[model samples]
Target: KTRPVLDLRPLPKVMADPEQFPKVVTNLLLNANEAIQKKGSLIRVSTSEEGGWAVLSVADDGCGISSAFLERDLFRPFRTTKKQGMGIGLFHSKKIVEAHRGRIEVESEEGKGTVFRVMLPVGDGVREDG
Candidate 1:
């Protein structure tokens, strides 16, 4: 499978903590790469401004997550599917997004794909850069 091809849209400038935003996106990209079953697997990233929100999404066309894992295990402290360590990336991402008055949304289908969208409030006066 090919890593997801990106289809990024122009995103508006958002009022955000520089450090936390980068960490959030990096965590998502890492997770997308980890989900890949092969080099051909597809992973895509996109950004947009919508209805007072700055939306960033990372999607993978790899093995989709189980509903149980999505519902119960995800975002909980100390829960993990990896062999090496506790699953803190998602938890931390969630916290950071919420700290910025944002929310994380997830969608997945077994054997199909998964998508994680981080939606942050865009200040009323923030303008587009390009």
Candidate 2:
């Protein structure tokens, strides 16, 4: 399979913790890559705007998360599908988004794909450069 690709969309200025945001994205991207076991799988990252917020999404074409896992406490610390995983990625990601007054959402199907969307407010008082 090809390496995961990131499609960063143009975005408006927003206040964010520069240090933490990239880590959040990286974690998600890494997780997506790890999920794919064979060639031809794809991971896409994109951005957009909606309702006065900057929306970032990372999508992967791989074995999707189960409905039970999605509905349960999947984001809880130490909860993970991987035997060696600590299950803290989503939990930490949610905390980072919330710290910026944003929200983290997920969409997935059993065999199709999974998408993680992060929405952060865009406006004055936010530092876009960082």
Candidate 3:
């Protein structure tokens, strides 16, 4: 099992669906875990504030993803790299983020690693880093 390194930073509150938002975190973590192809790999989960957005990022030093798949099929339903995956996790995660008026982004390099970032606007219109 690969253990995740956590860097949970404090941030201003954001408007989010309590139930749906958690699924996004869970799905991203699971995907990161599954991507590991070697022992002693690292998965880092972190939170921070950037430009009035509350960001939650999950990064992994795992098998990574192909540029083609990352660009064309990442957030699409039923597209997956896993043999047993049904592939709805990221699809629903994107929907949930968008529903909260947020956005999701990804960066991956095959044989290197991958990172997924979820960003939502600050609810009270406060900026943590001014």
Q: Considering every candidate listed, which one attains the maximal TM-score?
A: 3
Task: Give the C-alpha miss distance for residue 110 in model 1, angstroms.
Answer: 1.9
lDDT of 1 by residue, 1-130 (tens): 4545676787766677898879999988888787775322888898888887889989988677889999998899888766666799999999998878788999987778789999977764333641
Q: What are the per-residue Cα lDDT tens digits for candidate 2 across 10-108?
A: 899988899998888888888778766632389988999987889999888878888899889767888898767789988998899889988899998
> In model 1, where do residues sit more than 4 Å from their true spots?
38-40, 124-130
- Pairs that collide in candidate 1 are 1-40, 1-41, 2-40, 2-41, 2-42, 3-41, 3-42, 3-43, 4-42, 4-43
- Please give, for residues 1-130, the per-residue lDDT of candidate 3 as tens digits: 6777999999889999899999999999888888885423889999999988999999998888999998899999999989888989999999999888889999998888899999998975344653
Instruction: State how far residue 101 of model 3 sits from its true place (Å).
Output: 0.4
lDDT of 3 at 33: 84
lDDT of each: 0.81, 0.83, 0.89
Clashes of 1: 10
The segments of candidate 3 whose C-alpha lies over 4 angstroms from its true place after superposition are 37-40, 124-130
Show where candidate 2 strays beyond 4 Å: 38-40, 125-130
Error of 3 at 24 (Å): 0.2
TM-score per model over all chains: 0.86, 0.88, 0.91
